[model samples]
Target: MGTKMIKSSQMNSWRRLDNSARIFPAASSVTTANVFRLSCVLREEVRPEALQQALSDVIHRFPAFNVRLRAGFFWYYFETNPNSPKVSREELYPCAPMNRRENEGFLFRVLYFGNRISLETYHALTDGTGALEFLKDLLCTYLTIVHPNIPLLSGWLDKPASPNAAVLEDGYNKIYKKARGFAPFTRRAYHLHGTPLPFTAIKVVHGVASTQKILAVAREHGVTVTAFLSSVLIWSIWQEELKGRPSWSPVAVSLPVNLRAIFDTNTALNFFECIGVGMQFNRSGITFEEILKVVSGQLAKELIKENLSQRNAYKVRLSRNPILRGFPLFIKNLVLRPSYRMGELTATTALSNLGRVELPKEYAAYAENFEFILSPTESNAIKCAVCSYGDRFTISFSSNIEQYHIQRAFFRYLTALGIELTLETNYFYDNKPVASPKGRKHKQ
Candidate 1:
């Protein structure tokens, strides 16, 4: 049996978009899907009927995710979706553009393929943290239903029958303070140039490594995992693209900071900001250690709470301006679409580290691993997402370009450091296997 549905009259009819999410609806297109995916691989193959019932039970618990995107006279808003969203089998490439009408007016979809259960969402819905929470609950409920005889620990799987009001509050609006100045201006950064993949295809490559090995490497370099990975990314770009070239632009990597860590809100809506970390390599013979030092130092300064608060305040202030708010939807879209494109040029690529994911010991035995994937844009042809569960640390690269130079460079750098990688890709041409070199062996 599934949980009962909440009546439409019991919930708010509509609500305004959060500060960071306001631009997604206007800027979303086929080229830039503005979508992301979170998947968990289980020990056993998925049962579609059980997964569907699990979604039915868990969907009503999260009111923020049970809504649809609706266009308003002045701005886009989320309205309560009266129909239930159904889970489907994964057929198309991951993170493809979502069609609202075909999806029953839902902003997100639940998908399953073999042992993997994935949740792909539109950016306007929520940030990665919020989505992970939802996935956690759904996974817990599904396991409980499927393994009825297994004894599980209490409190780990327990959740409130209904969501608190905090889950829907816009944290940005709640923590807004008047800003004294603007965020530091950044010059346009280097962009990756490549031949686009035909037929709107996406190439996904995942490099699975041991978490302890990577953490030890980061400690050896005296940097956090994110800092270490970002530095490696910058170094990869420098060596592969701009090593011997004379260019004024720096190789910038956009890092999305989850504000919930710094702010005092638990809203499941979008409440994160992207801060750019960049390094210039005009001169030759720049070592990897030097790049690490520069990236670590810059991250230290940019991640200050005061700096992030002021940046968020500035965006909130701009959005609340009376004159800007008065513009009609179409006019706002015209200005916003181009503004979004320009913002994309400020980063050579994006690297989002979701940090570590935790699962209760009772449930851990049933899970194999977890992955996070980011959608790529035309300007930023490749983006990376990092996630770890238990001993498995996965770095996934999603690219639309036909080149694998950067991906190869990244994993090779790690392997050269003595960290073995189990590489997997979705590139299937001429009937070749998905996992290269076959047998799922480590790439040394």
Candidate 2:
């Protein structure tokens, strides 16, 4: 049976946007300086009926799912006129789907606009950590509706309603309050020469693996899988340069880290901070174990800092700064653009690992495979993607690195270590001439 419905007022600080629900500023133009990458994992066995039922059930549990912006703040509604909503999966295309209305925000976008149904969101509303929780509950509800025999673990289901604004904005407020003390991301970029080498990616998956299995393996190895697999990817690109794409040189690997869980705040906002992870592979002595150790150590330290929030807080502040507040968001994005960025790809591409998904267990079998794709930045050479089903890591990379040798070599190293991985190319933008778009601010 469906759970009780929630009133918008009862959901806290709920406001309404009286116009069509769409995320502008980011999508208003294709030439904006900020680049948001998209990730999608297509499961082989998605029961359509089950998925529909799941959406229907969660619609009440998360009233945010049925909402659309009337002005700027969030609002709750049992439903909107399908024809008047002006939102469909098409709006989220090339992006993941945005099925839930509450899931929509300034730094985020969610649209279910595909046949298989794709869930896409930009990096504004919240990071992957919050998104996963929403996904898990939605899937659980769906499974229950499809196969009633599966028992529901009520402990992990939706929380009861409340009216406090902080109740829904806890993490957001923490990050915002601490934003004044963080530092800016240091600039790091690699070069590209001649026709860029094209390395394709495949979506690989493993059936339900609890978060514990993946974390346990990492703990057992004394290193995070993100570190281990990232090490493997950096090496793979290095090898690719030696074997196939000879024209490329050494590059940096980028990783995006979510600070909410680490900071102990669970509010919803675009509250993620990214740090570029670089490795020195200029010589023959570098081993996967060594690189993994370094990467893992660095990430551990980055998360432990008390003042890291100040760095990214500036960007958010400037993005919504009240000074140029009147300028079209597009025009304002120019001044708001970061003068510097992360990820060293002189031969580099980014790697993003969202890590294992935690399911409440009773409905575990329903999840087939989970995958992630790193956000595509303005540069053609960057690509970051990762998703793990338990202890096994499914690694993927994005790059316009002119040399394939780096990636090829890294793949071989994993094979030698007996780490099972499936490499496939699911998407490519063709061999476009590689050139960094000149950075220019939008005119007000």
Candidate 3:
């Protein structure tokens, strides 16, 4: 759409996976799809042809995302995909496991349904920050093609300009340092029990609320938005699942910290680190305020740059170890698969906040909202993703479990706090129409 294209000269070359990306290829499975989605709801219906052309034009700019996953003798790598990427209609469930062969060997897919344009990608390709950049470019290109006369008020649409050396650089490897010790391994956390939906199907529930209202409430609590929501999630789990259980395991919520800002790098690779924040419920009558204080304090401590650097340095050191690098592909998979699964047991659930998304003034009028969804795993059946655009702050929950008790409790807790929410879901778990309570409405 910008009329200037930058192609990768090394389009036929291969590159090693980043430090954090190595585990995704090994842990990816039917249950653990290791895929995440970012969707933009526009004011009008999407045109497939225009979207396809936009992708073709913009795909060349993001060489990191335009490659296919390849298995090497000792590790997984990425090779440029020869086939052209295409836009498709949304046919399958959201965040379904990616099939590279059927998808032209690409690791990501662009889908459109009605007014929504969704970009779903394998975690190995990049983290949410990277994927969001690609999505923004795609949307800007598409909008430019459709509304050529609308002048953009900002320079945001001028991105995806050209791939710089830093764009694809592995940030973790670039900032590696020797650490005295690795972060202590977490003990097994309390898990929510529920009947699995047949066929590994995922059900998504999104609670949309006013960003300002939520922010005001969070300010009142003297905590960040992430900390407040996480406390609610932990409280919801306690109310719905862990309240009278005879378990000492903590209800830990894993929060993914975007290290690009902390480490000061612009590489669009997997550069985030997850730190678990939660509490072990020793007593039955714990209040949300109490949990919020603990969660806020833990976040403050774990989010420190020095602490994160030490933990990530240890991980990079382990990943680059000579002995581990020499192992055969099969042996590495054999070891990594189970090791990754065991790591899943270390957290009860994950909460990734993408923070605020911005758009040019002209384009903002055409976009209604945005959503981020995390794929669920067998061990951690429920995961949450949050992103805010305009005045809409959406919290989406993706789960394979049949029960909606936790989701219901979460929204109800917000409503009780005087914040309004508009609920929406795929309603695929039970295959029946579920009723919405008074004052709260369901979109689909």
- Per-structure clash totals for the candidates: 0, 64, 0
Structural similarity to truth (TM-score) of each candidate:
0.94, 0.66, 0.94
State the TM-score for model 2: 0.66
- Estimate, for each residue in 54-148, the C-alpha lDDT of model 2 and write its tens digit: 65555444433333433322222122322212223333213332233344332233233222233444433345665665566666665677668
Give the residue spans of candidate 3 off by over 4 A: 1-8, 152-162, 244-246, 428-444
Tens-digit per-residue lDDT, 134-202, candidate 1? 898889889988999657567545556555667888999998988764754467999998888865578
Candidate no. 1 TM-score: 0.94
Range of the 10 consecutive residues with the lowest summed lDDT in candidate 3: 435-444
Residue pairs in collision within model 3: none
lDDT of 3 by residue, 312-347 (tens): 888888887899888998999998999898888999
Global lDDT of each model? 0.86, 0.46, 0.86
Q: Could you list the CA RMSD of all candidates, in the order they appear?
A: 4.0, 9.2, 3.8
